[model samples]
Target: MSANDPGHINDLSKDQEESLKNFWISIIDKITNKNKISLEDFYDSTYGNELFNLFASDNPDVVLLRRLRARKWNVNLALEQLINTLEWRFQWGVNQLVAKGESELSYQEILTGKTFYIGYDRFGRPINYISVKNHIKGQFPSETTEKLTVLSMEIGRKLLHCPVESVTLIFDMTEFSMKNMDYQHTYFLFNLLQNYYPESLGLALIVNAPWIFNRCWYIIKRWLDPVVENKVHFINNIDELTKFIDLSNIPKHLNGNKPDFNYIPPTEQDNIMLSAFQNDFSGNKKARENHQQASINYLRITYQWAQTNHNKDLLEQRKKAMEQLRDAYEQLIPYITTRTHYHRYGLIEEPIFYKTYQRIQQENQQESVHF
Candidate 1:
């Protein structure tokens, strides 16, 4: 569809998203059923399924399914969008986009705490704060918004040790004005967050929005589906935000002085889910550092006589092994995105997948299960 498609946002129905769940169980089954070699076996197992092999997992299947939901379970459309984003990542070499520290030079320019990820809330959801006035129009690079947003999310995932799958965005529009509100950038950001990155934003608390923001948001809200529109809220100040997220995780710069509680975990959330992402960040970073040297050693290897000679079959086996190693070393962003889009995919009843999803559907029956 063209940019001018009027029903672009609403064309995909919410019901469609809720009906496609086990493809998820199938995904998990696919990962676990690989040959008993090692953790490296996961990639080869993934490749066995043609539907999955079409694109590499820059992020986990949880996030991949979100894109699918965004397109109402239309796998082809969702895959196309996913591939476009992946192609962008490959071209930019953004797969290596690591936030070294809060002060890391790579992304520090965007980490002025203006649109920065502070920490996780009580529910283990990452809480991001965006100071609109600090955002000077045309000041940063063209991809500044995109890069900063993605980095914030990646860093958020690293910081969150719990099984939280989504993020809570705080748009602090304290000094909001036409001058500070970059219309072009705002338009671009909306499309990126809504169309490109879906099922990731859990809540959007728009605080201190000026009259102009409300006017603009009014028009924008009309285009949004109710599921998204309902998440957007207008708040007066920081005090109001405390209801959804505890004040402890809020930054000191944002009038959050007492950092006593870590958003006091919900009474019912004592036994929170813990996703694999919590432990993978540091290991992934270290792997990237030595990855080049490792590649050199591989290239310098002397092959067997059969492979070196005219044996096509032997050479092909060698090539497959090489690809598996390369793929194994490549890092993918660990994710357990929002479970609201979960569906049973009632078509197939493969026993293993059915059992896994049966537990999942039960866990997520009453509410959206984290991770």
Candidate 2:
């Protein structure tokens, strides 16, 4: 064979090409049982085949077949089905790439005991196919809440135990719905997490809808304290949120106290004691702390009371009340800092945080690379 000859390396003759095409046709026919299948069935059975053939062929019938196949099916429907299949395959391929990347990255991070924030969707759906694929491959935290809580706890544990100072708790709130939001639905939902764990360094609540941000604020503020209000944040887009997260001094604020339970801070000691006694600790430590702190920090808050001549005994009572106020903090501090009481009361088991973190990180990386 000449050095430049194309025939040198197992080049197929015309007859062989014809025979191979016949063989493939026979295989396809056998697969379809030689049945006269409808265009829908053809597209369904052999996805994008007709389309591919039409693109490759000079025959008019192939183009006609595509149009005929698309008649009963709306453009969107046909397009959607084809796109779904393509997307699925693309996702699968992307997932494989992610798996390799994650194995390398996760192994390194785990070995080094490094803390990294992995963002996840609300359902703990893999943010990327690779994470999803690896999760499916490794069978990590199967349930959504379990996965998220486990992720949270893993990061929390790492922060608590390792040299890592903090962890990023990233979540996209685009699909979050207050109407469908349930506290106990999953083992590690957002609200349940707020109740169960301390607020992390910061939270990235990705809100594409402005109204959703308001709703999320309500749900989060229900459990977190005013101090940690800065920790909870809202962003209109992922890019904005990510940028803000990097800046580290993004502005955040409380949703403001509810009007129904609104009360002015007590000015006198007697009032503070009465307020403390009547204060509701219905939610978690964060809520209770907000109430307690609001009461103590603003001891001079004015409230309407029947004006009466000041009495000496009443003044002493106020002094005693002030003493009681000082004592309450000593008691409340431990309660707030100790293990969350609700966590023991049928709160879901500790979630698999590290696996979730790894899964999310892999997913995000896959998405960035693929889509």
Candidate 3:
């Protein structure tokens, strides 16, 4: 790489850096309506209201950067895509669904264990296991399956940290047959990730894919963008998979050390947080108000950060604001959300369960950044 090439030395190219600044400036102008709109109103509108509150506390810089990179650093296209995503989240009730927790889907849908997250990859990316044989077309509502898929992706998102913004996917095709094929579901997953959550798939392992699946893959590859299709790998055996993920992280069935997936149903006790909130409405109301204030403050700082040119002091302020926003969100979690299997099984911790992978890495004292 040339020393003069900023892209090689920094996270963003000079042109991309400028586009990111302009992107934020444009959104702030549009959302604030020429500085007429209040910061609180701008926060609620763009973040999709209280329904999206639980999942809305995100680092503005990271969020905007992801969209910019997805659109190849084109500000207008990225802005359009961002708007479409927000509109879709509202129209499809995705914000509400995610905020309410994964309970929105039927018990049986989750029990099937067709799709769920497990351990993290060597790169600190969460591993999402998909048992292809476990899926039977027409057995579950298409919409329900879609919801589950989205929920799983959201779970993976929480586990992610800086420099590891993607998830590792393992599609166990041990039995592989035509009966397992669902073009509709496949297309939805492919398109959804490509368009809305672009550059979010680190790797995809199609394990033990039978010969017959090769024919289907030929057709499927045509539907993928070359960049995405290249990230996919056809694993012939355990050895092939071990190359990408540690054996300790892979399941025993796949010739790895980890235990196989087993779903533990959620119980009434899992709603302990919700029950607490209901029992003490007044106290919970105060907590919610504090959270709302923190949110508004974060947005205010973010807006200011966006307008000013980059500087060490401003960046520190933005970081502190993000920490405060996260702290408020953590404190309000138990009063607002329901627990899931991830919580019950101890795979996740309540009241601020994001970034499990990062936590694990810190505990193990692993600081290397895997590529």
Candidate 4:
């Protein structure tokens, strides 16, 4: 490829690359009912197609290419994997899953407690820990485990803001018991990560794997595909995990030098507003009203502060303040917009998000250029 060329050199054989490309092209054609690429064409496709569009490196060809690489490019196997994953998404409602949050699920918070974003690895990948024994007990341990695994994966990918990181999942089977182990759920979780969320797993550290873990691992081992197998690491000691994770970033629970998992209450005004929103959403009308007032007051304060303190000397600080103000104002706009959920207090006004998005874009451009 020439220096000016945009695409990267493919590691695949010419025939194989073309085959994958053809597969992608055929699928795109089927989805759009058209041969060509266009804005509307990509948009018309549903979640399955959207995954392709979002993941495509300049084109749809790479979407299948990654899947092919993940599955060793066995055409029949790749096609099966792709179709199965899309089917899973349809059944699971992958998009709507995170949008509703953990409130809908009774076992969510307990499940969430089991998984924590401890810190980042040496290569800057986010390190997430899952205490397998913590929330393994429920009416159906398998279902609970699966939901928590998916939630952890989703939160790691979307909410955590690790721009250049694939999350490292440390399955801490400390103080383990035979009953805590669910081979079916373990296999399903591994398969889910392998198929749908391809290559998001930088590492899988299995620490403190007691003798009982062997029984489950015997079954689980067979289920892991080659890609997943490569990522999996069985650590005898938790301290061994410190090689990837920095000392300070490591939580005290893991026997690291850093502080314990001190729950940092939402310090930002926006975050506080979100807490109030949750309270309001959970049938507390007063909480909703309070959130609205707080948000409005925040916006006004930031605006007045910016207007009065027009000191060119504090350009950077002013920009940060403006960004905060813009965000706070956006939050206020969405508060009283409309009513949606039977449980939640206010309506889901998407326009606030769109407006915030526009402001963010403008702010980004403004920030890029030195004032």
Candidate 5:
């Protein structure tokens, strides 16, 4: 980290940079038992498995920041939280869940369109809608619904581009009643987001929350982390949401401009790559190798960046390696995981996906001045 460039990676301040570096060092030390070890070597070891690949696919710096922010920049606590999350994921077989792709959950869950990503907010964060009205207690098995939620989070992660790390969650509570209330399900979700996916939620809007939800919310709020609880807002009307989301992005059922949720089943064409390479073991092996090498390269660069005290040149190299890793992961997706609605419709490729809050704000200001 150059002294002149305090916000070198992801616009982090000097203190924040120091904390992030400390976190990296601490985790590395734990993994290496205080012995010096190169990142490439560790990445090749048994410890650096699929979960490590998952973290690499997600920009590791951003992932670290998410945990740090969740713990208010406390390195030790963030480390604990992250370790717990990794342990949970391993125990819960999250890698297999992701590897199995969209089919792991029942078709009924997909048809209900209970949860899905739509358009993004003004700041380019994807908006994930949870159709509370469609969900009835015990309608689906606990494991199935949990998997659906994890799949949704995994998809949401893909939608996030740089400078837009979180997603807005709208729990559309229109026509909500006592039968729709699932306290256990709600607890699992909030706990998962707060602990495992810290800072992944930008905002949560309880839209059209029925009068019955009041009692339920009182209990639910107690289960949330203070930071997460603060992000939850009750929206009585669509206009109130416009402060964050443009009307064009909101669903029409909520009296906004966009159409309601529609589930598009994955067609054969959607899995064209998988179909093409199904029997070609050599091709799949090569793709996996490419992705693995790219991931290791990223970790190697990141380790150098940290060891060099965040040298400006090493930071740039780290960034380039991160991009290479992301590209590799995308190339490997078709082979490793099945295509979801986001890929089929190219939702994440929309122009809005590339915009940052600063760019959007500048454009909005220019429009206001023109008027």
Candidate 6:
């Protein structure tokens, strides 16, 4: 490739870089505003209040709603604060779990508090006291380095309490590889907990490696049979994880009681709203078509309301009309791309195309001046 070719150089001109940055900032700002407004409107609705109460409790929803309102007004700063809060809460939970002597295998050992050493073998399997101690020294400090560690553990504890004879713990192997012990420590603890404390509760922890999931479908099916399928708890985050364990009624579950809430199904309206949100401004032509059809259907329903209630206030009807217009605009923006059309037709691939054309025009003017 020629040295002057745009692709050959990694750096952009100062003005070009500034233009790109500004474009990205504008897009982020627009998305942030839309996200905040949608979330706020949802929260203010009756169904939103009910959902919030079910998840966060009655008292905390007030605080959460206030934060959410602030986020609607100042989205970027609120998101940063939210991240910090979650991180702090997660660390606090881990500290509490460790302090409760829940980390140790034996209750008697915890009570005695002897300076016992543990060791591991070549494969990092727990071998003896001395080796385990060495492994802990090497890996324990930053072992569970996830934002949702406490919630993940709580889900594990709940799944262990299930009435079924055995349970399978499935995790993303790609994520597991980032950790120090390569998930060996977690596997060992799961097996140990199953064997020593709750012998009846058979535990099988499976790491679903990237390619393995696609190739080993039969193996996964064999493991998830009638015996273990009901007890199995698949977890990606703490919020979705409440399906496996009930945090509110923890003591009852520990004392051999079954969990109260089995699962929460997504409401039909919520599903529709989510589907609308996903396909709203998707770059794909097919997605835009689907969203347009959905918007048409919604408009038809609202139009019927307008017709049936002749006495209904004019302002209410106008408000609904405005919402429909906004939805129409959302559906249309994806299709109208003048700049992208030029690029697709091989007109230009770089911002320098404009600059080069402008420079050529300037040189011709200088030659004309000489003439």
Clash count, predicted structure 4: 1
* lDDT (tens digit, per residue) of candidate 1 on 1-371: 21112222223334442322333333334335544432233333423222232222222334555676577777667656665654555464343444222222324444344665565566667677778887877667756565666555544444433234467888888877776767666665566566656666678888888787877786677667677778888888777877777777776656775332122121222112112233335544554444333332322231231224245765465455445434534432122121110111111122332333344446556446455
* Maximum-TM-score candidate: 5
Residues 1-371, model 5: lDDT tens digits: 11122233447877898888888877766655533556655655444553465574677777787788778889999988887887788778787787777878889888897898888998778999999988899999989999999988888988887667789999999899998899999999998899988878889999899787889999999998887888899998877988879989988888889988777777864455345535446656776788778877876666566666647888788878988887777656545556677866678552221222234346558969999
- Summarize candidate 4's per-residue lDDT along 246-277 as a digit string, tens digits: 77866676777765433332235434444444
C-alpha lDDT of all candidate models, in order: 0.50, 0.32, 0.72, 0.54, 0.76, 0.32
lDDT, candidate 4, at 130: 76
In order of appearance, the predictions have TM-scores of 0.53, 0.25, 0.85, 0.61, 0.86, 0.18
List the lowest-lDDT window of 10 residues for candidate 6.
125-134
The true-structure Cα RMSD of candidate 2 reads 32.8
Question: Which of candidates 2 and 4 is the stronger one according to TM-score?
Answer: 4
Model 5: lowest-lDDT 10 consecutive positions: 350-359
Backbone clash numbers for all candidates listed:
1, 5, 0, 1, 2, 12
Off by over 4 Å in 6: 1-168, 174-184, 199-208, 211-371
1-371 in candidate 3: lDDT tens per residue? 11122332136666776787788777766667743777776655644353235244555556667677678778999888777776666677766666577768978878778988778888777899999998999999999999998777767766675556678889999887899999999999998788767767879989999899988998899999887898899899777788889999998878899888888776764554355445655555776777777777766676676677777777787778778877777766655555667777666655443342234335446535431
Give the number of the best model, judged by lDDT: 5
The TM-score ranking, best first, is 5, 3, 4, 1, 2, 6
Q: Which ten residues in a row have the lowest lDDT in candidate 2?
A: 125-134
lDDT for each residue of candidate 2 in 112-197, tens digit (9 for 90 to 100):
21112322223221111011111221222224323333343432432231122223444433344454333343223443333323
Candidate 4 backbone collisions, by pair:
338-347
List the candidate 2 regions with Cα displacement exceeding 4 Å. Answer: 1-148, 159-163, 177-180, 185-196, 199-201, 209-213, 245-371
Q: What lDDT does candidate 1 reach at residue 189? A: 58
- lDDT of candidate 3? 0.72
- Pitting candidate 1 against candidate 2, the one with the higher TM-score is 1
Q: In angstroms, give how far residue 309 of model 5 lies from its true place.
A: 3.1
Task: Give the C-alpha miss distance for residue 6 in model 4, angstroms.
Answer: 17
